[model samples]
Target: MAQLSDDCFAFGGDLMPVHAALDLLRSRVAPVTAAETVPLADALGRVLAEDVVAPFDVPPHDNSAVDGYAVFFDDLQADGETVLPVTGRVAAGHLLGREGRRGEAVRIFTGAPMPAGFDTVLMQEDCRPIKDANDGDSVAIPAGIKRGANRRKAGEDVTRGSVVLATGRRLRPEDVGLAASLGRKELSVRRPLRAAVFSTGDEVREPGQELPQGCIYDANRFALIAALRQLGCAVTDLGILPDRLEAITEALERAAAEHDVLITSGGMSTGEEDHVKAAVEALGALHFWRLAIKPGRPVALGQVRDAVFVGLPGNPVAVMVTFLRIARPILLRLMGAEESEPRLFPVKAAFAYKKKAGRREYVRARLARGEDGALTAVKHPRDGAGVLSSLVESDGLVELPEDLSRLEPGMTVEFLPLSEVR
Candidate 1:
């Protein structure tokens, strides 16, 4: 059984800055368990736990890049076309037995290993064959051809003993192909982080249930679970917990005991029915931080035993925002993943908006390129946190800086791509 301390629950002073809180959270987390094995086909998206070094050159030998004649460049007639005797034919996977003799050319096809003493290849389309004393025995080579042209040299792509992939690289399809090219049958990768997800609040009902006058179905849990899966986490859906201290506490205890991290939405704010904070405090520690961000002002971060706890807002948009802004970094750290800064691009604002300083705001916006070829962002009609339909119609989020009070049309603002958010 795991245990938690209440040391973080004593929030007696002003809330800490988001960056500062994140630093503290990251410093306290330990790396997850890791293992290594051969998973050539199923290794995509797994984080590399060790560096991969190449044992051999990518191209084992110099090979022909085209179907042509292999020749010694020095023997070519510089003034005009030079005719040479065709020594032998070399195709892919078959090499000429002996080195090329002076004034003799080897007839080679694409991917044929370059014979010794041969330095250049003339494409079959670039040369005209001439008849010799013995038909099919000799051919004429063209002049003005450079040395080493159309020849793929060995060790060009990857050299032996070179570091092909560093630790913490997430293996993608291309990475897997590269590893296969290097003859790697196995890879060492960090274990996927196990996350237990649940939702709270008496007013929240599971989908397919009849909704009461003031109740709504739980959507955050499913959304978060899908997002977690996309992030390569092994997620366990713990379902919904009522707004009762005992029930919430029991769920937290069970989750902490079985999972690497526990995540819950709603019931962390100051409402009378909010029991998530109390349950976290009773289990271990709870740190409720007022994020200087619109829509998602209340966010919680703490730990229960060895399992990390993240509390997201009940509002749909707030849940999405807080998870991307805060939870993503911590989860990646726990998984021993490399840190990649979110890609932000500049887009011209198409509408004017008013906001206060000292609070970050992410507005759902649709992007379009104007007739003049300038990219522009237009705000969604509804800015409410519950308008999830807006997100479905938007391309990405327009980031309003913490110091900006108003945004005017044609002003350049940073845009966070939705691809990066999930």
Candidate 2:
């Protein structure tokens, strides 16, 4: 369970900006503080509970970067071609027998440690070997090559006792590989947050079931389950709940007792069929009623016992938009993940759009490369929140800030790709 600061919701007004609401949401919830050890094979997508310190230097020794000939810089001829006897061979994982005298070269392969007293390397391509046996295998190299040009220094990537990873970092593929490089067989990470997801509506039915008159198939719950799973949550699909306060409240109470969060769709509004808001109010507390955002204005946030609750609109596009913009960050914080804003890339807009100045809006847009070969975001043909096909047809969302009211073609705007938030 987590606690919030008392003044987290002090907006001093009815509606708040998107950033303001996000900051308030973040200020209230605390990250899960429990940890469990898991093997590195199962560490991907999990948040680290503690900082990981490197045990030793990455390479452990100075090594050659390429297959070349190792030589002492001082042994080279000052003004002319220098010839040296190929005294011994040093292969990777194998060492040379002894140090060579003046005017001598040692054949070295990639990843082989720099031999004693050797300070320079010459690629085999630049050296010509003499065929005469009297010289006992010799190479002639030109003078004036720089010292230490083809060597990789030890501790270049990671030094001993350095912090390799910070706490609350969501482990990516490269991060996992780094732990492996530090000789870590297991990582301590926060346990996945348990989420109970469902929907409430008499007009909604499962996709495989026969649709009744004036009813549509439920898509939000399925999509929500997938998104939660992507965020490394243990998701339990609770199916659809009937449009009754008792049924929704009972289900939410039971879920709150066993899970870390309860997520429901389509019942936060004031319609006669809406019961999720009432159910949460009866069992726990409702912290927020709506966000000042178009397409998904009726989003709700609350808590039931120790479990947090999120209520989303019924429109498919709005559901996706609100979840990405609002619920995703909150869920991540609850799972002990470090806060990270979704990445936004600046691109030119190819379509014109007009939106209200008071509400934050996200337009479904497809990206196209112009004749100048720059990516330009084009708004989808339809802007209806219920149009689920727009999400599939478009590449991502073009975010319009609250202060701006007009968008002209070729104007620079921030484009957020769909894959980034996921």
What TM-score fits each model? 0.89, 0.92
The residue ranges of model 2 lying beyond 4 angstroms of the native Cα positions read 1-13, 77-81, 97-102
Error of 1 at 152 (Å): 1.9
For candidate 2, give the lDDT.
0.88
Best by lDDT: 2
Per-residue lDDT tens digits for candidate 2, residues 16-120, read 567877887798777754799999999999999999998899888777888888898888887889888888889989878676566788889999987777878
lDDT (10s digit) by residue, model 1, range 313-377: 88998898778878887788888777644788998999999986766788999989876898899
| Angstrom error at residue 314, model 2 | 1.0
